[model samples]
Target: MTENPYLSVFTLTKYIKRKFEADPYLRNVFVKGELSNVKIHPSGHIYFTLKDDKSRIQSAMFRSAANSLKFKPEEGMNVLITGDVNVFESSGQYQLYVQSMQPDGVGALYLAFEQLKKALAKEGLFDERWKQRLPSLPRRIGVITAQSGAAIRDICSTIQRRYPLAEICLFPAIVQGPQAAPSIVKAISSAESYGSVDVLIIGRGGGSIEDLWAFNEEIVARAIFSCRIPIISAVGHETDTTIADFVADMRAPTPTAAAELAVPSREELFERILDRKRSIYRSFSHQIKHERKRLTTTQQSYPLQFPERLYRPFTEKMANLDDRLLRNKNDITANRKHNHERLDRMLSYYSPLQRIKEESRNMDLLVERMTRSIQSDMCKNQDNFNSIIRMLRALNPLDVMERGFSIVYKEGNVVNSVNSLKVGSTVQVRLPDGTVEADIKSIKMKDKEEDSNEQ
Candidate 1:
């Protein structure tokens, strides 16, 4: 027994594959490199080459891993892939079997997920047009979550608290692990089958990206979108968002919020109904009371009883009104006549004709006084004018001549001094004449004695 000296290729491959899988170190590893020559297989697998500064390695990620990835890995994208290094015994080559991968030096898959989310948002995929509106009051709320999860319990308790009358139907689904996406899709479809449900609440408790990835799956999101009933997507914590959440009619931050959205408050609805009933009752009562008062008044009304009694008061009032009217007319006439007489008396006091007569009499007396004053003023002014004319006549040189006054002149000039003549000089002499040329006969120093003797 040479222990099957010739081993089949299949048997040898299986042996090598088993050894590689069994090795603990080879099963799990983290490889950091730049991706290259990446190609997607027809079987939903991916084959790529990871290269660094010095070396290149072949790698492959099965459909399972590729399905979970948020971004498509392209050539030249630096990545840190966590997977196993396994040798392909048939090809006599080693390749990295990728489980999960991410861009190198990046924080986590959450950041990449946010980036993709924002990019999709720009395209308006998460627009309000695509979003559905939650039902105001759902009679039956179908919750798709883990059967043992706290999300289901919280949602049920909250819904019951808000509206105890509402029926809650829980469609248990896998909220974690790889089976979560398919489970959620199936649950949504099942809820749709039950036409009694008005709304669907799909969610789970807070978890990591891997645990919450079911809500981010395209299958679950499409299922939510195609649902006829409104869906309230509550995934992870308040900050966690998924494709299903964006596409849903409403998004609740937590499972409790989802319940709150699905139902209305029983207490509030009851209170509103009670208030409306009271209002209707009060309104009816007020209308009845008003009608009764109208009926009672009609029975007591004079027009409703004896028709002639209605006119009796009017007949008496008419007579009294006529008498009062006549009295008012007489009073008005008397007042008008009195006012006319008073007006005439007042007019006589300040009449223009009387004022003119009085003024004329006053003017006659004023004219007599003025005439005397003018005579007195004329006598004074004439005396003054005569005295002024007499004084002027006394100062006139021609008046002096009229009084036989004579003047002496030499050389056409009046001369009152003997010095005016020069000794042995020609001079003109005249007595009150226009002009005179004279010759001085002598010069005299005894002018004072001569002037005194002449005076």
Candidate 2:
């Protein structure tokens, strides 16, 4: 058999890929389509289908090209793509390897600006709460802009004219093109790290958006936001707005206006000082007049005109009290004298010797009567004592004991009944002359019927 002439699948695909690469028209192509089935891979590659009307083509943007894109691509978005058509060798399919992409009807930069504005706003970067208050009088003003531009000149001149006392420190930076954002950020950092400037004025003269894009950069915006010193943004004209403006502490329409905002006016300060001085002088004069009126009123008052009148009433009251005291003393003396004379006369009426003699006679009579009465009472008492002694002798227990009767004691107490004596207990028997100790051998109690019959 003859050798097979058919090409293998890999050989055919390789041939097609070479053909697509060789065609100059396919090498650089521009296509407009609506995105579909868009997917962004974790590796930063974008894969999608580009469709318009009835036709669709597979497309891809590798990480290198995707990184250059300013706005994100989404499904159903109308976009213009620029890339080369090539075969995906493994799949044997031709696809557009996108190099650049932009929204179909908008400038890429403007769209990027709007998209960034929305994102940062949603993150609260544009909130009023994050804005710092500008100093009323900044001592050192730092300026960040082109080294040799109308912006620097205008700002320096305006500051010098308005507030000569403020020291201007120029931080020269590039304010245009791609390098401007990094330059502005570096200048802001230098000013912050320097730690001496009270306020910063970052701005440039009026320009197109393309010329002023550095101020809109996210890095520059964040730098302004993170600065410790207060920042005032002045870019382009009155109508221009950028991310830096939104994040700065304040915004000015022009560089000159930024300078004017940074420091106070010397003339206005002088006027205020003069006004305060005048107010102080007027207040002092009014106070002096008020004090003089008070002094005059005091000098013309009744107490000052006739000073003795103030103490007259007190003096009269003192005199009256003294007179009452003297009268009370004299009256007390007369009463004391009268009492003394009466006591003396009564004492004279009873002489000590006569009183003693009379008392002695009365005492003798009383003694004699007491002696007779005591003797008569003693005789009567002697007769009554003899009768009681005889009666006691008849009733005495000892007398009865002498007559052949005895007393029995148990535990030192007299025993009156046989029931009080236990058979094993010891007791004492008392006679007229002696006590005899004995143990009870037995006890006998009288029968209740016999005792009752005897009673």
Candidate 3:
């Protein structure tokens, strides 16, 4: 057998590079680490080393790619990079060229929430002044959350146990998934349409940050911020904080806590009812005592019946009353007769029928004047109409054409002045009979001798 030739080190390295490129698994890989050494080239290339406690790897991102980054990549910052592994053709070394990057710890979603919170805070959405105060005892309350979620059940049970009199209207929606954001916004808007709802509880069962992302979505946040009714944001565990909680009128760590915030305690309300009953009873008892005293005084001062005891005095008073009554009647009859006579004199002096006749005469005179003015205006309008008709007839183009005059048109346009009639220009002459196309043979703009003779 012939002796085999060994390959050089460069050739061996090139073979290894080919093998790395051929591996499908190297096409896409995700890395998590803290940035250690970072250098930016003048040409917009970013070179960095990502290291954790034990190991490290080199990473590079071109300026074109770095420009799309939302947050600056700095040293000591942990990050997650999605990119591919490839050999540098010049150096014969494998490295990661990142396509996109984000903060590593807490994942991209949590970082995004923080960024959005900062931005919305600048716009006053998270300001405490913009939030409304919740009523202590609302007549009706709206609860917008997942219908099947334990949060809803917990809130319902707690509300029933605490304050059963409060009316709770449930606006159900998806509390998770891509559809959750829009569904939450819709539920909030629909709750507003109920018009009489005093407070709204928007929340769901406690879970991971990912599970509660719907409450942090911008649409849901904005809807909560703009709600006319007060909102109680109850989401996740006690330590969990979301955008909804920050913008809501009140924040509750759990759904049961939110229910407690929305309504009053039944035992406390019953105590208050009892106090009111006692006050009313005292007020009625005082009134009854006052009336009973007044009745006793009246019964002791007055007589029930005195038939013969009052008869003698009454008879003497009757005789005097009869004489006075007769005198008063006579005086009344005379005064009535005198008043009747005065009324008759007043009727004769100022006769309503004669006044009506005089008013009728004045009305006829006014009618006659109005009729004359209207007739005069009509005659003037008729004369103006006839004059307008005569003027229009004189200016009519057809009438001029019938009188043996013609109009010249060039290129479908009427030539109104002699300046438009250029020598050797073609034009159409319109007459009563028909139109005739002709060429200008001579130019006669104006004759000075004819003008002098006319002057």
* Candidate 3: residue 228 Cα off by (Å): 1.0
Candidate 2 error regions (>4 Å): 2-9, 36-43, 289-455
Better of 1 and 3 by TM-score: 1
Residue-level lDDT tens digits of model 1 in 240-320: 878778878899999999888889888888898999999999999999999999999999887878988878899999999
Q: Which is better, 1 or 2, measured by lDDT?
A: 2
Candidate 2: residue 274 lDDT (0-100): 100
Residue-level lDDT tens digits of model 2 in 82-131: 99999999998899999999999998878878877888889888899988
Q: Predictions ranked by TM-score, top down?
A: 2, 1, 3
Per-model C-alpha lDDT, please? Answer: 0.84, 0.92, 0.89
Between the candidate structures 2 and 3, which one is better when assessed by TM-score? 2
Superposition error at 118 for model 1 (Å) = 5.5
TM-score, cand. 2:
0.64
lDDT of 3 at 384: 100
- Which digits, one per residue and each the tens of the lDDT, describe model 3 over residues 289-350? 99999888766653524455647688989999999999999999999999999999999977
In model 2, what is the error at residue 184, expressed in angstroms? 1.2
Choose the strongest candidate by lDDT.
2
Q: After superposing candidate 3, which stretches have Cα over 4 Å from the reference? A: 1-26, 29-77, 85-102, 275-455
